[model samples]
Target: MSDISSFGATAKGLAKNPIGIIALFIVLIYGFAALTLGFNPKLEFWERVPLVWFLVLFPVAVLALFGWLVSQHHEKLYAPSDFRTDDIFLKKSQISEKREADFQASNEELDRKILEIVNRLSKEQLEPEKIAKQVAKEVKDATTFIVDGRAFLGRPDAVFTYPIAAFETLGALTDEVYFKLSKSVRPFQYGTTWVLRNESTGDVIRTLRMLTATPPGQPLTDIRTLREVGIHPGNTLVVEPPPC
Candidate 1:
């Protein structure tokens, strides 16, 4: 959820006329000065220096510095409040090349698996049922599964669950999951899911929100159907399930 209440109307009103808003603030400050100082034209330079330069400029400098500090500290926050993302590119790049190469190699393997699945389904003789059997069998044999490109998946014993199903029979992959919404589907509903997996381990590392709400009855099958609803098939939702 976003904090729209404080920002929406205020931003809207300010956006309508930026110059007018600035002018209004200036007028308020001028009015306050007139009431306090009352047109003192003949004051000495020392007195005028205190009033004009020290009092005004000192406060303005302090305010400018304060604003700069706040911006530096709060740069992570954006409009709509709750919407934020981590900027860790520099930090990631600082890691050793060996580690980066390893991650890339894993990603390539995940891609190979996705291509394999798609190619298998495209075969003329194979239908959804066969695909499900093959996929499940393959998953059972393999240590992990790649879902979309965001998450990595591998079966792990209980006590190692860092995320959803960490201890459950459901496997964990090595991909990083990201939560995002899709606008490609119609009649939007919540609980849409997407996954990202490491290319090598076929592990799901990332899970994202699909645009649609959960479908009643059984979970959806076929990546194309998820896309039809404006969600991506990816690796996780792309697989076929046993028929009801």
Candidate 2:
């Protein structure tokens, strides 16, 4: 956010910076000299300077080609990321950073919740017999699964189903988290960390240590399956916002 601002604000900020001023001065001088030499190409100085040297120094045609090349590749190989000037995204880039920050905050909240849950399950709730009583009230199956998506102040929850048998390494099989969240009603905000919780026991089952943990872009196999992470069919999972 330190550098995020409109074009006019950016220009004003740069104007106040000494480094920017020096860069601007250099560019202006180069541009002026190039323009002067460009229109007076037939001047007597041309007799002493090689045409190839002049082209290398100026390179107006080269710059035009560069523009054409960018035009051909834009949106395919490249895209505007400017917070304010991106027309391709319909100015969505302007809010892209804010959304990223919001997602980060959401993930932090989930992590906090996960830590609390872990402490409760391991430290506070020391009685395994008490935990058994709680589970006795709720039946758990080892096969079918239900995951409720929670985005925290975002869109409605998206429910997804998964078969325990298919709970293989998401990093190597199917689309990482999608193989689990694929049945969701809405496409979740990508790149958020995910934490799985057992609704019946209020137990924190799994947590994505990083964004790459469940996503397919980077191949990282999970050593533990859902069952290994304390997931069960009767244990309806609440997927908190942020992950893959």
Candidate 3:
């Protein structure tokens, strides 16, 4: 296994160097040509034997000569002191450190945004309607701005329903009317509002009320609340919200 691995690595190294690859190709072609000429039926038995021996030994001799030449100039071809294995490891370490730093910076920014939102909501004089709008806008901006999960990156417009009961409820609320969710459907949190639209006519259907916890299995699918809305599995909830 080790021998095979070593040979593979050697072959890969040789392939990277065009000169080495060309030399190998030449050797193979010449060896095949030599074998063909050596076996010519017109030659006598004794002559054919010597010819075949020459054909076999000539390539071996050439390969030995190449090895000798390479050995003589091995230091010039690859200066051992110039390249260090430790240098490669050090570079890898630096790259890893940079990635970690970038991740921490992103986390800090998200925390700062959350803190700002909390402080705003805590203000005693803010109206309920204004607070609701602010929360919805924040949720929309956060969902669109920071992409994290598989669904966010790939299908940012669609909301997944099965795992979160809130998403299931949202789907129920928007049924029959054409409505869009944010690029991603986050867990229902205070102050967020999801806008729904009419699918066929591209019109505003209705805006979902401020985000609130609803008991699981509660029927949010009120026909009076939604007009001609249909929610089904595997449907892509539009990402772009309807114009105000």
How many clashes does each candidate structure show, in the order listed?
48, 4, 8
**Residue 59 local lDDT, model 2:** 60
RMSD of each: 19.5, 18.6, 24.3
Clashes (candidate 2)? 4
Error of 2 at 25 (Å): 77
Candidate 3 pairs with clashing backbones: 175-229, 176-228, 176-229, 176-230, 177-229, 178-197, 178-199, 179-197
> Across residues 117-178, which tens digit of lDDT does each residue of candidate 3 receive?
86878675687787778766664444332111223236544443331112313334443222
Residue lDDT tens for model 2, 159-219: 6666544544322222445555555523332334344556888775543434345542443
Q: What is the TM-score of each candidate against the true structure?
A: 0.25, 0.29, 0.21
Candidate 1 vs candidate 3: which has greater lDDT?
A: 3
Q: Runs in model 3 with CA error above 4 Å? A: 1-19, 37-39, 46-50, 75-244
- How would you order the candidates by TM-score, starting with the best? 2, 1, 3
- Give model 3's TM-score versus the native structure: 0.21
Which candidate has the top score in TM-score?
A: 2
